[model samples]
Target chain A: DQQVKQNSPSLSVQEGRISILNCDYTNSMFDYFLWYKKYPAEGPTFLISISSIKDKNEDGRFTVFLNKSAKHLSLHIVPSQPGDSAVYFCAADTTMGNQFYFGTGTSLTVIP
Target chain B: EPEVTQTPSHQVTQMGQEVILRCVPISNHLYFYWYRQILGQKVEFLVSFYNNEISEKSEIFDDQFSVERPDGSNFTLKIRSTKLEDSAMYFCASSERPRYASTFRTDTQYFGPGTRLTVL
Candidate 1:
């Protein structure tokens, strides 16, 4: 079963606009969420992460908001840039261990 | 900055042949892991190792697969016999601690570029 899911396979946003990506999870045991960005033929690069204790975490133009009651989370990029274009993957970690469950990923395109 | 590195960026092997994928995690990182992504699929966890022993492994990690931390610097994944279905991009990651909240150098994992293995 896919405990973590990213229903949207692709998303597009114009440069200088906001880009939002959504992720949902079925496992309540997961407490830590992370986002990773990847390019073709390269391993995933760490983006941003949020802990269960907080509802939101922001770094620079990237922000992650978590809604525990809804079992959902999202990543938002303001004033999106072409460099931000890449496949974004959402991952969840359960208390059992540090191993992560990753979503299929959503490809984001920042159109100029 | 230190980063995880994998050897033989690409490998093509015949079915039923043995193939060994190698990785060298960042120095001083205590925890190690292996994850695989089939083309057009999500990344799946394979195994995690610490203190020279396998701490945890997924159901996908069967008898045919084994992991070793030989000596000090090298971590290897060996598939006793290759299968056409074994083809995928394999990534090696390492973290300094066991908690996800820790920094990649301390808690989060730093991933290698990845090794693409194709079994014919």
Candidate 2:
């Protein structure tokens, strides 16, 4: 019953490089997708989100790309820094539903 | 800078005991939700409340679980006669708009630092 999935459990990137985390969903009913960054012992912080109608959305150094056809979405961080290291969770919601479905999460480590 | 907040950062209770987890959502937010994640599992939705009533709930939220906005600013989740399998990190979240709102911009959610419930 895993509607959303993050195949990669962990990823590492060098400082000033690009770090990409990917997520996939099986439910076509999900009309919105979002990415959240979570630090150890803290709550998840909303990073960015994209509507199913759009393919890409960018905010500062973070960008999210959505491919409805593939039912895939990704979060990309440019010029990665140590502060960017954290577990990233991908969540999706249906237009008619209030609950969000979340992935297991992908841990990203940006080495300085 | 208003944010969701939860009490009893960690609660250790024995099986068959009732435990109440509390939360205070942002003042102006209109929606409140509860979610949990067992160690090593994905975050799972428990219930969503609006207008003082539950809008939706998952299969995991059974007869033993209930949510209430006891007051304007406080939201609570109560688990009756807890089971060992109920051990998990419970989170409270708030959103400014409902998913069906015409202006919905993904209805961004603000989450509180979770409460770790350990049932022995």
Candidate 3:
């Protein structure tokens, strides 16, 4: 069962533009959401995360927004750079367990 | 910054042979986890280890699969009989604490570079 879904298979944006990647989850029990950036042949690196209690969390150029009502969360990269080009995976976890459900991932290509 | 590390960046073995993937999680981390991703698929959780015992596991973590913290620094995943379908990238991760704790809010999981297991 695919609890998390990232409908967008790939995304392209010009450098220095805003890049928005979206994700949706079917399980309401997911109280924590995180975004990870991965490069070829490498493991995913934690980018940002947002708690269910908070609507948004920001770290430098990255920001994560969560809409509990819609069971959706988004990762926003401001002034997207070439270094930001990679596969982005959105993950969710419930408080009852530590297992994380990951989305199919969205490949972001920030054109330089 | 200290990071998780996995041995044998790539492993290739016969379908019926046994394979072991090793990992060294962050020293101070209390929780350890194993995850895998089939080519072109989303990452899936296999199991979680805590205090030298398995705290949770996914259905995919069948009887063929097992995890152990054999030593203070080494965590291993062993597949008794590897199947062709078992070929995938296996990742080792660790967290200082669970995402949710009684007093704390959240702690992010650190993942290793991953071991690409190829069962021919």
User: Candidate 2, clashing residue pairs?
Assistant: none
lDDT (Cα atoms) of all candidates against the true structure:
0.93, 0.93, 0.93
Name the regions of candidate 3 deviating beyond 4 angstroms.
B102-106
Measured against the true two-chain complex, the DockQ scores of the candidates, in the order shown, are: 0.71, 0.91, 0.85
Write candidate 2's Cα lDDT for B69-88 as tens digits. Answer: 98889999999999999999
lDDT of 3 by residue, B27-96 (tens): 9888999999999999999999999899999999999999999999999999999999999999999988
Model 3 C-alpha lDDT per residue in residues A10-67, reported as the tens digit of each score: 9999999999999999998999888999999899998888879999998898999999
Backbone steric clashes in candidate 1, count: 0
What TM-score does chain A reach in every model? 0.98, 0.98, 0.98
The 10 consecutive residues of candidate 2 chain B with the worst lDDT sum are B99-108
Compared with the true structure, what per-residue lDDT tens digits does model 2 show for residues A1-112?
Answer: 9999999999999999999999999999998988989998888888988889899999999999999999999999997999999999999999888888999999999988
Model 2: residues with Cα > 4 Å off, grouped in runs: none
Specify the highest-TM-score model's number. 2
> Against the correct fold, how does model 1 do in TM-score?
0.97
Q: Candidate 3 iRMS, in Å?
A: 0.8
Docking class of 2: high
How would you encode candidate 1's per-residue C-alpha lDDT over A55-81 as one tens digit per residue?
A: 999999999999999999999999899
